[model samples]
Target: MQSCELSVIKYILFTFNLVFAISGIGLIVAGALVLSDVGEFDHFMEGRILAPPVVLIVAGCIVFLVASLGCYGAIRESYYMLMAFALCLLIILIIELAVGIAAAVYKNDFQMTMKDLMKSSMQRFENSKGDRTAWNNIQTKLKCCGVEGPTDWPENTRPVTCCHATREGSPPPEAHHCRSAAPQDGILYMDGCFYQLQEKAESASKILIGVGIGIAFVEVIGIILACWLASAIKNKGD
Candidate 1:
C-alpha cells in the first residue's frame, strides 16, 4: 500500500515481464517450426497444428501478454488494469490445464508415432541383409534409450546426457548409461522403461506446471491485492 512497497512490486513485475516476453518469443518461434512441418511430416500440416511445440508457443504468448499487463498495472498503479489482467490470466490458465490433462490422459497419436520412430529405425538395422558395414551405418544414426544391461560397447557420453551408437555388430547391448531427460524433446524414461507407462516426464511436467501456474497466478493476484489495498490506504489517509 505504501509508496515503498508499490515501488518494489513494480520492480518485481518488470522482471517477470521480461521473462514472459522472452519465453513467449522463443515458444512462438519453435511453434512455427512445428506448424511448418519441416522434417518428416511436411504434407501433414493440418495434423501438426496443435502439437506440443505449437501449443506451448501459444500458451507462452498468452502468459507473456498476461505478465505484460501485470507489469503495466504495477507501473501505472491502475486497479482496472490489474483486474482485467487477472481475469484473462484465469481463463487462459484454465484452458491450458484442461488441455494438458486431456493430453496426459488420452495416450494420443504423438506417443505412438514417436514410439514407432524408434521401432522403425531399429528395424532398418535389424533387417540389413547381413551387410556388416550397412548395419554399422544404420547404428550410427540410431539412438538407444535406457538399456536393460550394460551396452556391450564402451561408453561414449556417460551418465544422463544424450545417446550413442553400438559397437561393430552385436545387438547393441542394454544401456548402462542413463538420462535425466530424454535426448528427444517430449520423451523421457526411467531405468530401462519408457516415460509413457509411468508418465514420469509427462506427470512430472504436469506436477511442475501445477506448482508453477499457481505461483504465477498468485503473483498476478498479489498485484491486484496490492492495488486494492493501495486504494483503501489512500481513502483512509484522506
Candidate 2:
C-alpha cells in the first residue's frame, strides 16, 4: 500500500479505537449503575439476569485495554503491537458473536424462566426481608401487585405500593378501594408482575444483543485494519 493509503488506514484505525474506548467507558458506567441499583437484592437475582451486567463490565474493561493497544499501535506504526491488537479484536469479536446468538436463541425461554423465578420469589416474600423489599420494588416500579395477580396476596390485605392507580384511571367500580375494609372488594393492582418483568427483560436483552452485534462488526473492521497495516509495515521493511 502507498504511504498515503497507510496514513489513511492509520487515522481510521485510531478514530475507531477512540470511539470504542469511549463506548467501553460508557458501558462500564452503565453496568456499575445497574449493579448499584440492584442494591441488597443482588443476591436474589437469577444467574442469567445478573450475568449480563457483570459481563458488560468485564467486556468494557477488556475493550478499553484493547482499544489502547490499537490506538498506540496505529499511532506508532508498530507491527508487533498491531498484530497483538488484531488478535485481541478477533477474540472479542468471537465471544460477542457467540453471546449474541445465545441471547437471541434463548430469549423466549428466558421470559418463562423469569416468570417462574418471580413466582418462587413471591412465595418467600413473607419470610425473607430481602425478598420482600425486592418484591415491593418490583411492584412499585412495574405498577403490579403480585406474581399472578392481585388475588395472590392475602385476603383483604395488600401493600400500599400496589394501591396507586394506573394511567388508565382508578380500578373498576367493582374493584375494592385499597383503603376500604371490604374483603369482597379487593384493593390492589390488577396486573401481575410477571408480564411486566418479562417485557422489561426482553427489551433489555434485545438492546444488549443489538449492541453486541454492532460492537462485533466494529471489532472485525479494527482487526482487518490492524492486520493490514501490520502487513504493510512488514513488507515495507523487506
Candidate 3:
C-alpha cells in the first residue's frame, strides 16, 4: 500500500480495535454479573432465563481477541490482520443475531412473568382471609435470624389457620415458618430476581449491539470512500 493508503488503514484499524475492545469488555462485565449475587441476577436465572456461565466467558474471549487482532493487524502492516479483523466482526454480528432471535422466542415467558409480578404485588395484602396478626407474629418470630423476609407475604404463606393451630408446646421444624411455604416462596423469590436480571442483560446486549453495528458500518463506508478517494488521487497523479 502507498503512504496515504497505509495511513488510512492505520486509522481504520485503530478505530475498529478500540470499538470492539469496548464491546468485549462490556459483554464480559455483563456476563460476570450474571454469575454474581451482586444485583438482581435471580430474576434472570429464574424460569429458564439463566444464560450458561461458560457462554458469557466464551463470548468475552471472542470479543477481546478479535479486537486485539485488529489492533495488532494495524501495527504489523499485515493484510492478514485486516482479514482477521473482518472475520471477527462478522462472527460477532452472527452471534448477536442468534442471541437476539433467542430472546424473541422467549417473549411469552417474559410477559407471563411480568403479569405474575404485578398480580402478586397487589394481592399480597388483599388475601387476608383472617386477622393479619398472624403475619406480624411470623415476622416477629423470623426476626431471630437477624434478617427480614419479603414484606408482602405471598399467598402461599400458610393460611391463618395453620399458624393459629400450632401449639406452643410443640415447636415445628425450622423449615416451617408460621403460615409460610418457604420452599415455594423461595422459588417465587428466585423468579422475581431472575426477571430483573434478564432486563439488565437485555439492556446491556442492546448497547453492545448498537456500538458494534455503528463501528462495523463505519468500516464498510470507510472502505468505499477510501477506494473512491484512491482512484481519484491516482487519476490526478496521472
Candidate 4:
C-alpha cells in the first residue's frame, strides 16, 4: 500500500511539473509580447520602464530550469532533489510577490514619469530630427494632436499629421489649414497622446501584476507537493 501510494504521488508530481514547465513558456511569451508592445514607444520611455517584462522573461527561464529539476526528482524519488526543488519554488514565489507589490506601488510614479518624459520629448521636438519623426509618427498613429492637445503646438505651426484624414488613406483637404493656430471644426484630432500612452503603460503593468500573483499561487502548490513528496521518500527509506 505504501509503495502504491508513493507511485501515485510520484505520477501526480510528474504531471504537475509538466504543467509548471508549460506555464514557464507561457510567461516567456507573455513577457515578449509586452516587451514588443512597449518597444514601439521606446523613444518616449526611460530604461526603467522595461523592467517588468525583462524580469518576467528572466523569471520564466528560471522557472523552466527549476521545473525540469522537479520532474527529474519525482521520477528518481530523490529526497534531496525534491527538497531543492521546493526551496527554489519558494524563492521564485518570493520574487513574484515582490515584483507584483513593487509594480502596484510604483504605478502612480510611473504615470508622473511618463508625463515628464512626454513633455521633455515635446520640448525637444523641433531641434531633434529623430524626435520630430517620432512625434509625427506617434501623432499620426495615435490620432492625437500633441502631448495635451492641438493647442500644445506652437501657434500656427501644427503639423499635417495633427490633422484628421478626410477619407480612408487620403490626406485631409486643405492640409495647409492645419498649420493655422485654430483649424476648422473637426479638422484636427482633439485628444492628447499622453493619456493614450499612459493607459497602455498601465495596462502592461497590470498584466505584470496579474501574471506574477497568478504564477505565485502555482509555485506555492508546487512547493507543497515537492516537500510532501520529499517527506514521503524519507519515510519510505526509514
Candidate 5:
C-alpha cells in the first residue's frame, strides 16, 4: 500500500510540474511578444507599461526552471533536487504574493500615473509626429476626441479624426461639417479617451493579479507534494 501511494504521489507531482512548465512557456512567449512591440509605444507611454511584460518574462523563466527541477526530482526521487525545487517554489510564491498585494494597493496610483502620462502625451500631440500618430490612432479606434473632450484641443479645433461624419460617413442631422470654418459642438466626438484607457488598464491589472495569485496557490500545492514525496522516499530508503 505504501509503495502504491508513493507511486500515485509521484505521478501527481510529475503531472503538475509538466503543466506548470507549459504554462511558464506560454507566459514567456506572451511576454516576449509584448516586449518586442513595446518600442512602438515607448515615445508616448515612456516605457512605463513595459515593466509588467518584463516581470512576466522573468517570472516565467524562473517558473520554468523550478518546474524542470521538480520534474527531475520526482522522476529520479532525488531528495536534494526536491528540496531545491521546494525552496524555489516558496521563493516564487512569496514574490508573487508581494506583487499581487502591491498591485492591489497601488491600483489607483497606477491608473493616475497612466492618466497623467496620457495627458502629457495629449499636451504634446501636435508637436511630436509619433504623439500625433498615436493620438490619432487612439481617437480613431476609441471614437474619442482628446484626453478630456473636444475642448481639450487648442482653440477647440478638434482633429479631422474626431469628426464623426468624416469617419463614420453617417452624420446626424445636427452634426456639422468638418470643413466648416466654425467649431461645431455636434461635429466632434463627445467622449474622452482618458477614462476608457484607465478602465482598460485597470481590467488588465486585475487579470494579471488574479493569475499571479492563482499560480502562487498552485505552487504551494506543488511544494507540499514535492516535500512529502521526498520525505517518503527518504523514509523508505531508511
Candidate 6:
C-alpha cells in the first residue's frame, strides 16, 4: 500500500509540475500582450503603468525555472529538491499577493495623478514638439480631440489628428480645413483622450490584480502538493 501511494504521489507531482510549466508560459504571453497594449502610453505615467506586466513576465520566468526543479525532483524522488520547490513557491506566492495589492493601490492613485499630469502635458503641447506628437498620437488612436473635449483647444486650432477622416487614413483635401478650422459636422472626434485612456488603464490594472491573485492561489496548491509529496518520499525511503 505504501509503495502504491508513493507511485501515485510521484506521478501526481510530476503532472502538476507540467501544468505549472504551462501556466508559466501562459503568464509570459499575457504579460507581453498587456505590455504591448499599454506600452505606448508609458511616458504619460512615467512608466508606472509598465510595472505590473513587467513583474508578471519576471515572475513567469522564475516560475518556469522553479517548475523545472519541481519536475526533476518528482521524477528523481529527491526529498531536498521537493522541499526547495515548496520554498520557492511560498516565496512566489508572497510576492504575487504583494504585487496584487500594489496594483490595486496604483489603480486608485492613477485616477488622481493622471489628470494633473495630462493637463501639464497639454500645457506643453504647443511649445514642445514631443508633447504635440504625443497628443496627436493619443488623439488619433483614441479618436479624441483634446483633454476633455475639442473645446479644450483654442477655437479653430485643433490638429488634423482630431478629424475622423484623417484618423481613418484619409487626409483632407485642404490641410487648413482640418487644422486651421473645424470641418463639417461629425468630421472631428468629440470625445476626450483622458477618459478613454483612464478606462484602458483601469481595465489593465484590474487584469494585473486578478492575474496576480489567481496565480498566488495556484502557487498555494503547488506548495501543498510539493510538501506532501516530499514527506511521502522520505517516509518511503525510511
Winning candidate number (lDDT): 4
lDDT of 1 by residue, 129-235 (tens): 43223223222322323222113222443222223433445342233433233334323222332232223335434543554455456545545654554464355
Q: lDDT per residue, candidate 5, 157-213, as tens digits?
A: 346776676345675323234424233546667777776655555555655566676
Which residue pairs in model 4 clash with each other? Answer: none
Runs of candidate 2 exceeding 4 Å displacement = 30-44, 154-160, 165-186
Q: Tell me the whole-model lDDT of each prediction, alpha carbons only.
A: 0.47, 0.73, 0.49, 0.85, 0.73, 0.81
What's the lDDT for residue 53 in model 4? 95
Candidate 4: stretches off by over 4 Å: 167-169, 173-176, 181-184
Evaluation by TM-score, superior candidate among 3 and 6: 6
Candidate 4 residue-wise lDDT, 199-225, digit = tens: 787788778777877788899899989
Candidate 6 lDDT tens digits, 13-50: 89988989988887888888888888787657656657
Clashing pairs in 1: 147-175
In model 3, where do residues sit more than 4 Å from their true spots?
34-48, 52-57, 110-238
- Candidate 3 lDDT at 80 equals 53
User: For each candidate, what TM-score against the reference?
Assistant: 0.46, 0.80, 0.49, 0.92, 0.82, 0.87
- Candidate 5 residues lying further than 4 Å off, grouped into runs, are 29-48, 166-184
Cα displacement (Å) at residue 119, model 3: 15
Candidates 4 and 6 compared: the better one by TM-score is: 4
- Candidate order by decreasing TM-score: 4, 6, 5, 2, 3, 1
Residue lDDT tens for model 2, 1-238: 4788788888988999999898788767766665555432443346776666678788889999999999999999999999999999888777777766776687677667776777677677668887778877887777787776766766544556666644467543332455343334444567887776656555556656666666777788888889988988887778
Q: Is candidate 4 or candidate 5 better by TM-score?
A: 4
Q: What TM-score does candidate 5 reach?
A: 0.82
**By lDDT, highest first, what's the ranking?**
4, 6, 5, 2, 3, 1
